[model samples]
Target: MTDLVIRNATVVTCDPAGTVIADGGVAVRDGRIEQVAASVELEAAAAGARRLVDGKGHILMPGLINTHCHAGDSLFRGLVEDLPLEPWLQTVWKAEGAILNPETCYLGSVLGFAELLLSGVTTVMDMFWYPEETVRAARTVGMRVSTGGIFFDPPGVTGDNLKGRIAAAERFFEMFSDAEDVFPAVLPHGAYTVAPENLKTAKQLAERHGALFSTHAAETRAEQADVTGRYGRSVIRHLDDLGLLDERTLLAHCVHLDDEEIQILARTGATAVHNPVSNLKLASGFARVPEMLAAGVRVTLGTDGAISGNDLDMWMALRLAATLHKAVTGKADAVSTAQALAMMTSAGAEALGAAGRIGSLEAGKLADMILIDVKRPHAVPMFDPVTHLVYSTARSDVRHVFLSGEQVVRDGALTRHAIGQTIEAVERLKPRIAASIA
Candidate 1:
């Protein structure tokens, strides 16, 4: 029997051809999309489906994917503000050290994932101290997550040594390697924080398991100078020299890259995750996204974390990804609306090696998608759905979110868990969070 059917909406399938179906919806069976066609074409399926959703006055599209985020850091939002990445990170670490445990990490992860899921993000690649807790929190909120053991030189939240980090990463693969909702990865902090040997170890572990390897790279000029002083090369060159750049590698914030570095990313097939809001807030210079896109590099989008970005809003990221470059480059057409939207959808799935499964709305892909209400004042008179999605749609317009045909978020609220309790818990922890850096 057909599991579910959604009809009577405009479907913005982020497929390679960019197919848009007016007055269309989708049918699902066994958690995968059975068909995506016009409402009239799906009338027969809707009649037999166990559940039917009317998507009137809405734009149905594949759910957004966030390629880089520190979800647990959501606990420290607005606590350590007005500092650059270097000093800001030191103070942030201080707060994390004082407060973060498995339980607290779980709470923060749930809070961050809740915000993302509600905002139409079905999957996120989060790097935090506790990978197991991250997965547990994602499951609680019924969303997909890509995370694994964290690699840091100093005693971070888990206080794990190099050996401990390796063991934990392996254990993570053992646990969730087969989980449909979990995309396991090994994430080191950054080139500046982790030693070259340690970074290579993380990459090797990821390669051995055929999982993802991600880290912060070239986010600031100071970061470039620091890495050059130590490694005798720029951050991207250093990583490339170490043979760490590849299809499975996700490099966050390639903001300080030269033209050659951009080509290097294209040649190596590594994905660059742009956290525009976090970069702007921290005063890290703008990334060469337009140039990278031109170079055939796969650039994706991310909401770094609430601590840096002040919110986990991919819509804001999408808007910035679409409009920020045009202003910076002085060319009104620097980044196209479709390109910006692809960064949050298909490009993100490609970054995680799940492009075949969850990126687009097509027959046989997972039914991980969202519906945005276009009846809003700002969304009226939509000329192009992609343009509306990139320029006009807000997180608040995400009326429904589905993951594998399950309604994880209905009416803009989480179905598996209530966010009120998470908010209240964070409220209780607010004083301690503020006092940590004081």
Candidate 2:
């Protein structure tokens, strides 16, 4: 017998051919999709389902995947804005040192996950120090999280030394190796923070453990110059020489790649995660997404962190991604609605190494999906669901969210804990967070 069945919805199957089914339904058995067909067909097939959800007048699609983020950085939202990458890093690092701990990390992660889940993000790739705590928070809210111990040499931080951080990362990999909803990764802060030798070691560790290797790369001109001055080559070249460029690598930012660098990424099969709103907010230059896509580099989208991104809404990023490149290149077809949707959905799942299982709404994939209410004013007069999703849909339009066939968000609210409690927790920490930076 199936666990749940959702019927009478516009099912958008983000498949290889972009299939859409009107008045369709989905059957879920044991947390995986059992069938996707017309409502009448599923009514006959899914008769044994324990629960039935009426999805009438809604758009049911795959859950959005956030490819790169620092979930613990949500606590620092608006704490330090209007600054470029370097100065912003200095301020954030200080704030992290002063106020960051396991408790606070969990709180910030809960806050971030709550925000993301409300906005239709089911899977998130987070790079933070207290990964175990983050995982705990994710579990509390039913989020699929990819994370691991972070490697960086900033003073006043635990594992401030490379050796200590690597040791911690090894421990994390073993601890979370068999975790169900968690994907272990090795996250070095960046080329600018980590030495070449250490990056090579981290990459080797990730390879040995069969985990994803992620890091920030080439987000700013200043970063490029610094890496060039130190390594006598671009940051991408240095990483390539260290054997860090591979299919398992997920590079964040990548907002400043040249033609050669783009070609290198394509050749290595490494994924570049574009953070459009964050890039524009930080005044970081735009990534050559059109060039990268044409060159065969797999590009995905991220909101970065709540602070620089201002919010964890993928709809905002989706719209910006759909429109920004066109505005910059004067080409209306720079990124199509389909391409933008793919970046947020399938490309993100591919980057997370969960493509075969979760990105698309297919028969055999896990039942991770969202129901967007199209009966609203902004979404009215909908001609194309893809266009409406990419251009008009808002996070508030998310009516229900599911992960592993379980409803975690219903009627626009979290299922487990009260969001008001999360807000209160963060509000209580605000004074200390402010005092730390002050």
C-alpha RMSD of each candidate structure in angstroms: 0.7, 1.0
lDDT of 1 at 231: 89
What lDDT score belongs to each candidate, Candidate 1 first? Answer: 0.95, 0.90
- What are the per-residue Cα lDDT tens digits for candidate 2 across 260-368? 9999999999999999989999999999999999999999999999988878888999999999999899999999899899998999888888888888999889999
Residue 380, model 1: Cα distance from true site in angstroms: 1.1
Candidate 1 clashes between residue pairs 3 or more apart in a chain or in different chains = none
Clashing pairs for model 2 are none
Q: Give the backbone clash total of model 1.
A: 0
Off by over 4 Å in 1: none
lDDT of 1 by residue, 1-438 (tens): 899999999999999999999899999999999999999999889989999999999999999999999898889888888999999989999999999999999999999999999999999999998899999999999899999989999988888899999999999999999999999999999999999999999999999999999999999999999999998999999999999999999999999999999999999999999999999999999999999999999999999999999999999999998899999999999999889989999999999999999989999999999999999899889999988999998999999999999999999889999889999999999999988988
